[model samples]
Target: MTDYSKELEIAKQAAQKGSEIIRNYTSNQNFNIELKGKNDLVTDADLETEKVILTHIRNVFPEDQIMAEESAGERRVPEARTWLVDPIDGTTNFAHGFPIYCVSVAMWEHGEPKVGVVLEVGRDQLFTAQKGRGARLNGSLIHISRITDPADSLIGTGFPYRDLHMVEHYLDLFEYLMHNTHGVRRPGSAAYDLCCVAAGYFDGFYEYSLNAWDVAAASLIIQEAGGEISDWEGDDNWLFGKRILAGNKVIHDFLLNAVEEHFTPEERKAEK
Candidate 1:
């Protein structure tokens, strides 16, 4: 078995470095903004933070492949193992100074995420996990909420900002959850949302049209936190299938049932 302590620490430091860069831009508001797509954005913070984080990782593990949002095109090695990075997971939130963005790092050894680290910068919360070592929030062990009943659950989700073709069907699913769960929150960050569910802060989270960089880290953290994660079809293809439903077992299945009913086979596929 691989020892992931060093990997976890490096991922944590990368996130911390990213947090500093994010806070700098948050206060100064002196960054160039780019429209990556309709309603999807990127900022200087995303690029700079990605640079620093990748620099540190390269210094330590030069052989590991990296797939970060801003700089992957500039620096990519053959993939034996890979590092996934979302320098600023909630760019819109960061650009607007909404204070809900984060840095996410995940180490994929072989093909699966072996360690995950996500720091909610504004909140000063660090959520981490190594495969087989239970998930943690700021060094304390965490677990999914045990509320097995659907009606009592608090769910979380994010809208497909880049692709709205399925908006009507997504709304149908959202409306069902709104009337069913205690409440639903679209906090504009998928990494943070997944950690919130892992910490039992929310009972479940589901979303579609997400990049692997957005959920790779948080997915491992959620699993190690005693939570369940899967695609809309209740399968393991979430990373690229573009659909995810995560929570305790009961709540996951409950959400999956709704998703299977609402999203058709074509809608479930990742946007090309």
Candidate 2:
């Protein structure tokens, strides 16, 4: 059997170490910044944090494979164990001095996330979850909100910076939700958005075009916190797919139906 408690402890330590490195770099007056794409930003802090995280993970699990945002290596791993690392999930926010970024780390076994950790550096909050175990925030148990009515639920979403064509589809869904739900928020960070849903701060969240490292840790946390997660088609293939929706069971279904209605037959076929 997997020692989930031990794995959680190690992940927590690694995340804390990475958070400290990020915090220190944020105070530097002359930190280097680079643009990976149109709206994707990277900084010295991101690379430094990844170094700290990878070193810690390698020290503990030498043979495990690593899938990280900054690494140029391939993600394929013939072994059963792998680590997903997003040293800084909100690099754009971090570069702009926004406090909504985090260090997300997850361990996968047999192709599923088995251990997850998300450390919000700005707030010093640690969120963790292990397969079969409940989720926690700062060592306190968490659960999804009990809201059932879409009119009273607050939802969250992230827009893809790389693809502008998808923006119209996203906006259509957003417009529908804005009129039906209580409110909607765009936090610009998928990892932080999932953490908020796990903590019951948001009733639901959905987004399109996200990478594995962006949602691997947060998805497990939401699942362990008594929330539901799936792709836009209301399926379980969230890890590899570009679309995701997460919320309490009731709200998740409601959001899924609304999202489906926003896409036309041709749009749906094009997405496929």
Candidate 3:
């Protein structure tokens, strides 16, 4: 039997601690915040959360690699296992007190996501998943939405803020989805959005310019919940390919074809 109880326990513990820290700082009127990019913002909560979570993980598995959004450096050890963390996803939302952010913890073994936990701090909802086992939301089994028709599906997407240069192209894709799908919602938190997908709240989700921490845990949750994910090229480069498309099998295929029809591989390469 595949037992990931230890990994899940550590992830939940760290995530809970991070959530507590985030909640404590959310009400602070005067907190340190910085701009990491044009629209990217980082706050003291992020740093502190990552510190606590990292410290806890390192204490148990000192030699394992830990790669967090706030901290990039990793401990390169044998086994090539890495813990991916997003202390606070949807920082923009969190800073604005929009209650749309979450803490994500995931461990990738040999570059494959094996375990994941996304804690929606605001709502105290925990979405967890283990490879080949299944996905759960607050201990209840969850699955992706079965909406196959794009026009009848509630699709999720994120606008291009960091790389405005791709805004026009992204807008084109957005326009297509907006017109073709029932409707689109951009929750500003990719991690949380993936959980939404896993819970059948959203039928499909696509975005660009995302980091590993933002999608690592959520992606695995989606997969374990019987969803499909890939890049614009319909490949497995979602981690760093700067693009991601995820949905049920049929919707995933539809989205991939739509992307292929919008931009050719040559056009994409030219832009790069």
State every prediction's TM-score relative to the real structure: 0.96, 0.94, 0.94
Error of 3 at 94 (Å): 0.8
Write the residue-wise lDDT of candidate 1 on 161-264 in tens digits.
88788999999999998898898899999999999999999999999888789998999999999999988778788886778899999999999888888989
In TM-score terms, candidate 2 sits at: 0.94
Worst 10 residues of 3 by lDDT: 263-272
On lDDT, the leading prediction is 1
Cα misplacement distance, residue 46 of candidate 2 (Å) = 0.8
Minimum summed lDDT over a 10-residue window in model 2 is located at 263-272
- Candidate number that wins on TM-score, 1 or 2: 1
Using TM-score as the yardstick, the better of models 1 and 3 is 1
Q: Please state the error at residue 66 of candidate 3 in Å.
A: 0.4
RMSD, each candidate, Å? 2.0, 1.9, 2.2
lDDT of 1 at 106: 94
Q: Candidate 2 on 1-272: residue-level lDDT in tens?
A: 67777778878999999998998988774579998888878888889899999999899889888898998376343347888989999888888888789999998888888999999988888999999888999999999999999899999998779867667877988889989999899887898899899999999998877888999899999999999999878887677666789999999999889878886644333132
Order of candidate numbers by TM-score, starting with the best: 1, 2, 3
| lDDT (CA) per prediction | 0.90, 0.86, 0.87
* Model 3 Cα lDDT, one tens digit per residue, 1-272: 56777888899999999999999998674568899989899999999999999998899989888889997864231257789999999999888889799999999887788899999988999999988889999999999998888889998888878877667666788889878988889989999998898999999888878888899899999999999998888888787667888999988888888777776574343112
